[model samples]
Target: MDIKIYVCHHKEGPFFENEFFKPIQVGRAIAKKQLGGMIGDDTGENISEKNDNWCELTAIYWIWKNTNHDFVGINHYRRYLNFAENSQNSTISLDKNIDFLLYCSQNIVNICRSYDIITSPLCKIHQISSPNNRQTAYENYSFNHFESDMKLVFSIIKEKHPEYYEASQISSGLDICFFGNMMLMRRDIFNKYCNFVFSVLFTLENIIDTSKYDYYQRRVYGFIAERLSNIFVLKQQLLGGDKKAYHAGQISLPTFTRTYDFSELNTKLGFVNHPAQTAIEILHGGTVHLVISFDDAYMLHAIACIMSILDRASVRDALTFHVIHDESLGSPNISIIKRIFINAKIHFYDVRNDRFPGLLPRNRPHISKNTYYRLIMQDYLPREVSRIIYSDLDTIFLDDIIQLWNISMDNAILAGCLDEGGLTQSRKLFGKTHNKNYINAGVLLFDIQAAKAKYGNLRFLYAESLAKHVRNITLQDQDLLNISFVDDIIHLPLRWNVGSRIYGNNELDYAYSEADEKIAAENPAVIHFTGENKPWHADSTHPLKSIYLHYQERASQALQHAQR
Candidate 1:
């Protein structure tokens, strides 16, 4: 029983190379041509260019369409199936060691002799609010626009492969399904699964509006495919005998880290004081503290968001900005941010070396890990700070900051504009009907002391929840915040955070109507570019695109002046 597992990689990394495993580069056709000889090509009989949409599954397609092996398997660049004894619960973190490779090369074939297919541990999506009513795997996908897509998938299956439709439906409702899309199976089973998944995904490609989705959400097809793999297995079991599969435990390894490495800076930079220990010497009686989180890549956007705040804020001089960032952000970017708001007290918090663990998850390529920074703000902000406004990098302030700061929390822990999209999808996501008002995390006014009192040691609680229920956290920090503070939330007015989704024809179900749209346009206190089309992108259709550019241009000029 010789097993060949192809480990997929997009960029160079310290992947293990041995007789059992081969490193294959996915999306090689559209990738830089210079990498032809250096990386494995996924061009012939492949969907290489759609890496953004297909993710690691493109490599799976390559393996199925091109490869000839007795037994085959697929794993990601960072994630792999752990085959070590008693290691079923833990993933093999491969560093500079080849022991993991040796163990897999030796044991994989033996394990396959007993099990027809080997898959990663089942991730169970349980009920969020009620213990009696647990959510199904189908319900989980439904939350992210997959409900309609799966309906189409089931219809196709029912029309074509009627025999498998009943089993597929049963599997869909079963909350436990193989996750990570990493599996080891015999060539025949692998071929069947591949044929089913790719066919369905290709059909979806032709039918679904891929162009309307943002870069992150466009990967819906891949997500659907992940669930389908389990459905395929379930179908086989229903037809064949039971116990045809084995659940193998896997581990997550840190594939890469982004670090600031600019050699031109004159000052030696390091982590400053801890948020808990840092004294609030700069705080005045009525000073408005604002917090924003982003990585170096989004420095320009963060600058624009801050600039917009400064431009419209009546209490400009009284505003103090706290930037939560990674160390990879160069000194030049930090200097430029300070230059943009020279009048405001700009403090930087480098979370690179912070002790908080598991706050960051396996984020999509587009989402920065810095997003998790907001969850740990309770531990990082000065104790003197009673209340603060936290905003996302994509937000632009359209009205005075004082208005947002003055909204009474009314005994609530936090206040934010209700998420129009979240409200519509609340039942599917949270399983609650009475509280349809889910506030967006993009723009929030945190009542610091109240929030701390409600959720004690937020960093610890967040880290614990993130580690245990990461799969449950579909929307990342937004989902975590909503789930954690579901009851103690105050819904602000829609105009406070008018998102771009409200205007487009592919608008969410809960989008503002024409009357509300006009009101938002006339009195939008904050404009959020929530969809895939951002103001920075060339194809941006945001009504307030010019405003973002206006601030961006000024930010660029300010940076140029600092450089000169």
Candidate 2:
């Protein structure tokens, strides 16, 4: 059987035209009459005069009223069914002039033979719950009086269609529900669904007071219909006699759009928007995990550090980045990082004062409280992530990080390169009894499971306790870590973390010999900008400062390019 799918559009843009797919301009009546010719006047649908309130469902209603094809489907101008691949992670752009629509046209008959309905992947509603403490899809509608309005919908269903009342209740209580109002089904079934849905919605239009709602919330009927679409399918399944089976499939929700911004998409994805906070995409199938902690002051350097890692690393897509930041770091910066490392998965954790209260003193300008975040990695990071490479923002990767990630800790709980100041400075600050091989906290490879077993939940407490004992320690968190994990520290080769001070100043006592310094200088996997002379500073005198400047310049250029 032949399939007919309408690509519902609002404004003028590039749209597809295959044997099966056609673009239909919706809201034709309310759209400016002068721009009608420009907005495909020849192929427009005549819906209600107030099409803005109905949103895209106006196009779905138009298709139901006009189309006579046996197999009918509805997708948005930006969204489409991802029939090219079976994987949920796969997405396609119809505007890219791809052959995916043609492929769908050829194979949809075979697909529909087995499945009765093809719907988009489930959209999850977060933190909203029913009275019984179960998650529900109802909270998303409760923005103004949307939830109260929905109660009227339930009452109507209970009064008019008593058989579907229970299913409607069950559908509202679900955490995951069908959304976007995008679906594919046989024409007869589509007609039955529309007949029942519009009858109830038309009745609601007479009763619900939408005068107080904003222009966006006035699109209440569309939102209500999306929830009701789930109920209709559930009701069919519950009262199964001749009703067809529902098959959940994937659809490509486009990220690149000319009409809307990422904020709209972010809100649709259920991201909580704090002031200047935005969402980052986390892709599936990550093999390597990395974590970093910084404030807004270090965001540029952190981006450069990540850029250097991506530039030098052989396997980029396998990596996942976990960033811990305070409120100072904005969403635009995170979005910039996402655009640069488009394939890699990036997750952001907002650092709160309550999580680690009293970890830092009140008047410490020399060291930031943000550095202490790495100490509590076990608490924030996902339990499945047992191993993570934590690095400071002032570092650059010269070799593949996958090499350092593969290093074996053996019996040790964590691994790090020895501090440039060595055990003598450690003893001077933390006392001889607390000193061993002092490892720099700038770069650390944590075998988290082993660390948890050895220290239990007392790692953070011990670090806090050690900070109390050593009040004069300059390294702050680093000194606390050395004193805490004194016996379990594993020393890595000098090449893993080569500090700039190791080459410039001979006054400080370094643990490595001249030969080790020469090897690290020649072939370093990571170059650490230790001490006060950072490359970004105008007065920096480090020999390898240009390496950082190169990445910093590239990061700037990438941000500029993305904004365009």
* lDDT of every model, 2 decimals: 0.71, 0.70
Best by TM-score: 1
In model 1, the worst 10-residue window by lDDT is 265-274
lDDT of 2 by residue, 1-564 (tens): 768777777765566767667777777766764233223323444454657888777777777776688888777766776554353324343334455566545556666786666677665653211122223677545532357779999988998878778888888777877677778888888898888788888889999988977655688898888888888888775654355654444444333322323244224322133232122232222367899987667867887899878766666776889987776677887777778778778998876754563445423464577787787767788889888889998998877777777777877877899887775455444432324488888888887787888778856556566656444455667766776777888988888898876646433455666677767766677889988778999999766777788788877887788667
Q: Residue by residue across 100-182, what tens digits does model 1's lDDT show?
A: 66664545666788778888877666544323335688886775554777898888778766767877788888877777688
Evaluated at residue 513, the lDDT of candidate 2 is 69
Which pairs clash (backbone N, Cα, C closer than 3 Å) in model 1?
Answer: 91-250, 91-251, 259-328, 260-328
Candidate 2 RMSD to the correct structure: 22.1
Per-residue error for 406 in candidate 1, Å, reads 0.7
Best by lDDT: 1
How does residue 310 of candidate 2 score in lDDT? 77
